[model samples]
Target: MTEPADIPSPERVLDAGALRALAHPLRVRMYDILSQFGPQTASSLAQLTGESSGATSYHLRALAKHDLIREVAGRGSARERWWERPRGSVSFTNPAVMKTPSGRAATQVIMSEFLNRRHQQLMRYVGDSIKTPEDLYDAAAVISSTTIRVTEEQARELAEQLTKVLSDASDRFRDQEGEGVVPFSLRVDLFPLPPESN
Candidate 1:
C-alpha cells in the first residue's frame, strides 16, 4: 500500500513537547484518523469523531503546533483548512521524554489509543469476513498466530528481518496508483509471551 510519500524511511521520535501535545485522547484519535484516511477539513474530522467543529479545529491547531500534522498546501480557505499527517513513520520511544512523569503518562495514553484503534479495525474485518468477496479474501487477507521459543537476541533479529521485508515491499509498491488502488494496513507483531503464573 502506498504511503503518501516515497519510502517508509526511518521513524521520527517525538520530543517531549510533541509527546505532551498528542497526549490527549481526542488528539491521539485524530492523529490515527488522519494517518488512515488522508486529508480532511476540521468539519469532516468533526463529523467522523462526533465532536464539535470548534473543538476539532482547536485540537488540530494544537497538533499542528508540533508539526504532527500540516495544512494541505493551497487547499481550503481560512475558514476551512485541510490537514494531513506528513508522510513518515513516528516512534514514541523517547528515553529522555520517558524519564518525566508527564511524558510517561502521555506515552501511556498514546499507546493505549493506538492499540485500541488497531484492535477495533481488526475486529471489524473479522466480523465482516464472511461478507467479503472471495477473490479479495483469497488474494491477500489473513489472520494468523504462531508461538515459538527463541532467545532474546533471536527475537530481536526476527523483528528486524520481518521489518525489512515489509519495508521493502512497501517501498516497491508505494508508487503504484490506478483505479483499483486502495490503502491496506500491514501489521506485524513479534513478542515473547509472559511466563506462566505459579
Candidate 2:
C-alpha cells in the first residue's frame, strides 16, 4: 500500500473484507488516534486505550493487513514499530459491496459508532463549556446543515470540490509549526435530500 510521492494524499475505498477487519471498536479508535496524532507506537496507543501493548500491536497488524493503516518507515526498530493512517482518507463508496449481508452489518456497526462518537464529542463540549477556557470555547465549533436540489452528477461534483478544498488546506498547513497551533476537526457530508412526502 505504498503510494507514490507525487500523488496527493491517497484515499482508500474499503471493500467488504476490509470493512469486516475494521469493525472492531478498538481498531476504529486506534485509527482515529493515529490520524489525529500522526504516527504512534503500539505502546503509545496502548497507553491511550488501556490495553496491553501486545493487544494493540495485534490490532495494528490487523489494520495493516487490510491496508487501512501501515507501518511508519524508519521511525522505530523491529522491537517497537510505529503505525499511521494511510494517506488522505477512507470511505465506504461502493453500494454493491455495502449491500451484502456482512458488508451491511459492518457498515451499520461502524456508522452507529461514528455517530455515537460525534454525539459524545458535542456533549463533552456542552458539559464542559463552563470549565473550558473562554477563548478556546468561543473558537470551538459549529454544526449546521442545509438542503438543496442536486442531480447525481451535481452531487458528485460538489463532493469532489469540497474534498479538494479540504485536502488543499490540510496539506498546506499540516507541518507548519507555529505557537498555539492545535489539531482541528472538520467533517463534511454531501448526499441527496430524501424525498419530501406526507
Candidate 3:
C-alpha cells in the first residue's frame, strides 16, 4: 500500500519549539492582540496589555524568535518597535508535541489561554449584538452549535472540507484594504463529545 501524499495547507502547524515559546499567558495575549488589532508598537501593546513597555518588548522579541510575530518594516524606531502577527492560521495539533509531559503541558497552556480569549470575545459579541448596527450585525453575527455522529475518519474528512472552504474565502479577501474593512476572527470548533454517564 502506498502512503498518502502530504497535502499543503494554508495553516502553519506549530512545532514543539514554537509551542514552548508561545506557552506563556502574556505572550499568548500579546499575540492575540496583535492578530486582532493588526500592527502595533511596543508602547501601544503595553497600554493594551497593561504591561510595562520593557516587559512587552521582552516578550515581543521572544515571539519574534519563533517567527510567531515579526517587526513591521520601516515602522516605529529604536525605542519602539512595530510588531504584527503573520497571516494564516496557527495549528496546535502537533502529535509529536503531545508525546511528552512537558510538551503536553505547554500545549495545554496555549490552548487554555486561547480558549479564554475566545470566550471573552464571544461574550462581548453577545452583549453588543442587540445594539450593533443592523447591516454589520446581519452580515457577521453568527453563533451556532450542531451535534452529529460520525466515524473518526469521517470527522477528519469533514474538518478538512470545512477548512478548505474557509481558507479559500480568506485568501480571496485577505488583502482587502478600503473603507468598511475590519479585522474579524473566523473560528470553527469541531470535536467529538464524551459518552454520557448513566
Better of 2 and 3 by TM-score: 3
**Which regions of candidate 1 deviate over 4 angstroms?**
1-8, 131-139, 170-176
* Residue-by-residue lDDT tens digits, candidate 2, 112-138: 766666677667866676576684458
User: What is the Cα-based lDDT of residue 95 in candidate 2?
Assistant: 87
Strongest candidate by TM-score: 1
What's model 3's TM-score? 0.86
Between candidates 2 and 3, the lDDT winner:
3
Q: All candidates' TM-scores?
A: 0.88, 0.79, 0.86
Q: What is the lDDT of residue 83 in candidate 2?
A: 91
Ranking by TM-score: 1, 3, 2
Clashes of 2: 0
Which residue pairs show backbone clashes in model 1?
Answer: none
Runs off by more than 4 Å, candidate 3: 1-10, 130-139
What's the CA error at residue 9 for candidate 2, in Å?
2.8
Task: Give the Cα error of residue 164 in candidate 1, in Å.
Answer: 2.1
Candidate 3 C-alpha error for residue 13, in Å: 2.2
